[model samples]
Target: MRTRITTIAATVMLTAAAIAHAGNVGISAGDYYSPTLATTLTAQGNSVHAVGWYNDNVLSTYDVYIQDGSSFADAAALDRFVYHGGTLIQLPWSFTNIAYTADTTVFSRRRRGTLEQLNPGIDVIAPDDWLLAGVTLPEAGTQTIGREIGNRFADGATPVLEWEDGTALLGYRRYGAGLVVGFDVHLVTADASPLSADWSNRIIGNAISPVPELSTWAMLATGATMLLLRRRRPD
Candidate 1:
């Protein structure tokens, strides 16, 4: 009976994953390879690629860029990309305060905390947010995250999920016409626990799609920029 129920649950989860946003996604893969993270997004019908290197020219191709525990040396390029309407997901070791990089240096240091093992382990702080769609506290409550990245959320950062102790588990902030998200959950190894994998993948799926209003505005802004560049072209 237990196995039957688990199978049903897995089917439901996979169905949800399948319906998620289908767009171009790039995951960091220079120094490290994050198979779980890559596979989860790919399952959502996205064209997932490993971004072994980056620059403004290369960054413009993808709709969303995910830094998965690899060193992203081009902060300025990332900033420019986000400003011009590209989504950014900072997972685990790629911690950074997108809107206010100077205000929170500690976040860049990347501190680690002990395992989270308790009832309601993953709290949905912003239940109404899209990031928690199809996710319930009961399903995620008992899952253990072996090591979590400690974060001091930047000003203007909104918390979508939290740890039992009130640390931000997942948060995001809009920058220019784009969005920047930070995750305490380890996407690289979230599959270590079935519940954790489900929870993290749901949040990431929502993020890549983003809210329609913001995404629309981003598209408009990018279009306007292109038009302006074309107008300035030498005849």
Candidate 2:
């Protein structure tokens, strides 16, 4: 009887761990892949795969898909995937404007040195959002100009993180039944500073990690209580 109780307890713990870490993520830049990003996601406890192309079948396999600034021909397939409840994370490349609603000239300026581009300070526009939870904005990264989003955002989109000057660094919105998240910095690069990399990793981890629902917590509590009760009942 004691052995059976122990087995149940072990099973409960394993189940909880699985629920907390189980997320299938795909990292892609169309034909270009980021090994650093893949390894980072793997370290964060998610099953990460490299996506070579964008299609309905490929997109459907992942709960979260990351587009690391590559241009692809199959835009419609990606749209359908998001429409049918697949989360998409976009990391725009150098000299491109993403998620901006208005003027693009603010991000078009060229930088001559790393010092001119790497800005570590960030402005938190959405402090209460779960994506920014437990993360300090000013410490997030040394995001470069033209590598992050501009201040203006599309309708219904929420900017969670931004440059000190108010240009968006990260943002998200709901599209159909899924979510679309945009990160302006190049997180996949090995060139980022240690502090910046740590912060970027933390945010990406938050994006891919699953939070257990209230019902799941209740069920686990009930099961554990029953097990304890059985173990203590005049045995």
Candidate 3:
């Protein structure tokens, strides 16, 4: 039987870093691969911004907001933009206040959590959710993606990927025309990793671009997988 957990308010252990600071950790010099990730977004044709927290105009201009801060001079403006139809990708503890807010209307609900390490576990994507197109999940259990959050679920929120512990590694919630996606996996921590770099690229790419499906591509993928598995199996 599969065990699933709902968002609950209680006591739990948090990551040393998270506990040390419940504040926004914006893109810094240490986030070595962040620039590469940004480059990928641009290559995939996304209008990426570093998110000017004080400027309301910035929020309205971009379709996707990559928040690296918590306090905003015009937070209401940002919320309104997302409330209407703007995609907000909240990175791990980027906006600490918003990240732990109990408001189900937004993404973060729980104020506490523990770290979960999954080595490219099974990632389930909903049919027709094209933001994650052309992205291949990790099949080999070598490299790991760390999600430093516990179970977080709310009405109208869809689970993009679930960790082994049944917590949402990635999740989305409907606000209006736009949506909010919470990513707990700290993919931006390192600078150089072949598999993780490509994976993060596509994940953000889909978030920025439309991932409409191609019938031919789908068939080819299915056929290829079957053929590869069949060849590897014992006769």
Candidate 4:
């Protein structure tokens, strides 16, 4: 009875996997903006990883934001908060205060050569504590991307912004598997137009393939043993 149950379960799982792989689903969160945007992951089977990218330029200083709900209605819902140097901070769901200053010394030290010279004439607003360049899975499931702001900087800088024809990589892990999503916004200059573009749609079609599940190997071994036993029986 136990063997029969296991066989039935495995068969069901295989059928589900076949159906999931046969029809792929994709999601996109049009452009980069403040507040959290929520979307679904399709073609990921029972378990799947998700990755995404944004133009670093969209963030004035260094901050990140995520989607709050399945739609754009609850865009202001606060999720996870991060600092310019990649430090995680805490924010209340209704919190809205976003003010900060750059560490001139650290900023200057990090900014050498062209970056230092390019600092002038550009507006660099320190991102709120609740922001991130990208998000990950597992962690993101509980957390969210906060608000995002794109700023204009001089060209030829080492780290470019998201709205400047750049790319940001965001990935997530699901069910011991990995999923990666990339956003490529080809904007010639720094502007909000790119933020309005449906970059997320482009991302859904570009999901990373999943790896083989461990159960597959176990099933293969079982099949091999059954074949050997049948051969030895020799009718």
Candidate 5:
């Protein structure tokens, strides 16, 4: 009887650990200038969430759009800052003027923009709703910008954006659950020099490393094992 209990507890602990470590997702972009961009993301489970941002002196004067899988026409508009699973966020001129200054330790001169729900039937979260911090360019010759997004529902999940010498911009997006995340960065800038640097490196450095679900399962297993060992010991 004691041996049986010990084995059962070990198994249970391992399973729990795997589950806890299994759900992690992340994405990032480095130095780019273009009308649009895209990346592939991986999610462990059936359900996952995401967020994004852009850095430029151009206020909210442009439109941002997202799509899942293939087909941009079917892209969902992410105008609001709400979590809606696979829905995309789109920005229009109405969502302009949402700018702020980037600080080392704090966010200054922050501005809030409204995110509208484009497809009511689909569940999607808007950038405005998830935007934790951002920075704006001062209309000077050039300005480096930064932006960040995070998974409000998950633990230890956040993304960061950094602009280098007003010529380049880097961004990272992270989420919980070993989920693969894909995204694109659209730069509506006149200059193309910013997008030269290899973005993959920046992303790898900024984005959080994915944690395997199996790890969580292992923890659970360990816990169970501990209980089992305790029970198996001669009383």
Candidate 6:
């Protein structure tokens, strides 16, 4: 009986550990920008995957998905994944890469005076949101020049971050069972100084490696209670 209790405790501890570890961050195959991303996230202890193929069940397979490619397999698949509770971080021009064939949804776009591009300033609309941890945007709410990158969301999308002209730099939209956090591509700063480069890496890291939920704690507690009860049982 003592051995059985020890085994149960070990099993529960393992489950608790797995729950705390969280999901893997999927970086698109040809995204050229993900190497730094992987490095930053890994340093923070997140399992990052370079995704080569995305078919059925693909969206649900990952905890977070960054639209890093110039092309994605299916928009409907992505939509389903988000509403189903998957987190998404996107880059600029990702709209051009994805063919939203499932519906007539229109993604918006605008150029800031045709010259202010690349490395645009980011905003933090939801300060308390878990996805925003270790992230800040000083250029928010101001006309900041970027790497000429530009993309906007459809009419119904909620703005999490916006450009100087009020375009979405980062935004949130609830689809089915998930939430989508859209990001402009140029905002990705990686492999630079600790103060600046690859800030998004922490964003992805924090997303895939979140704190233990109540259910996770409950599971751990349940196991402990079981062991305690077993120890006190009249043998």
Best by lDDT: 1
Model 3 per-residue lDDT at 164: 58
Answer with 4 or 5, whichever has the higher TM-score: 5
TM-score of every prediction relative to native = 0.68, 0.66, 0.61, 0.23, 0.25, 0.62
Give stretches of model 1 more than 4 Å off: 1-22, 30-33, 96-109, 113-120, 138-141, 147-149, 187-196, 211-235
Alpha carbon deviation, residue 50, candidate 2 (Å): 1.3
* Clashing pairs for predicted structure model 2, backbone only: none
lDDT of 3 by residue, 1-235 (tens): 0111111101111222223221221221223234555555555544444433445555556666665324332456556767766766665545344533332233435444333344546557563456456766666464555444554556677777765555565667766676677665554234433224576556755655544346634554455555556666897
Evaluate all candidate structures by whole-model CA lDDT and list the values in order: 0.64, 0.61, 0.50, 0.25, 0.27, 0.58
Worst 10 residues of 4 by lDDT: 104-113
* Model 4, runs deviating above 4 Å: 1-70, 73-168, 175-235
For candidate 5, write residues 109-197 as lDDT tens digits: 22232222111111223322122122221232232222222211122213232222221122222212111122222212335332122
Q: Rank all candidate structures by their lDDT, best first, as comma-separated numbers.
A: 1, 2, 6, 3, 5, 4
Name the TM-score of candidate 6: 0.62
Model 2 error, position 125 (Å): 1.4
Q: Candidate 3 at residue 122, lDDT? A: 53
Please tell me which model should have the higher lDDT, number 1 or number 3.
Answer: 1
Off by over 4 Å in 3: 1-33, 69-75, 95-120, 123-128, 188-196, 212-235
For model 6, how does the per-residue alpha-carbon lDDT over 151-232 read when each residue is reduced to its tens digit?
5666766665555544565555566665566655343223332212444555555556655555766777677767678778
Give the per-residue lDDT of model 2 (tens digit) for 110-177. 22212225565777787777676567553534444335434345556777877676566677777678
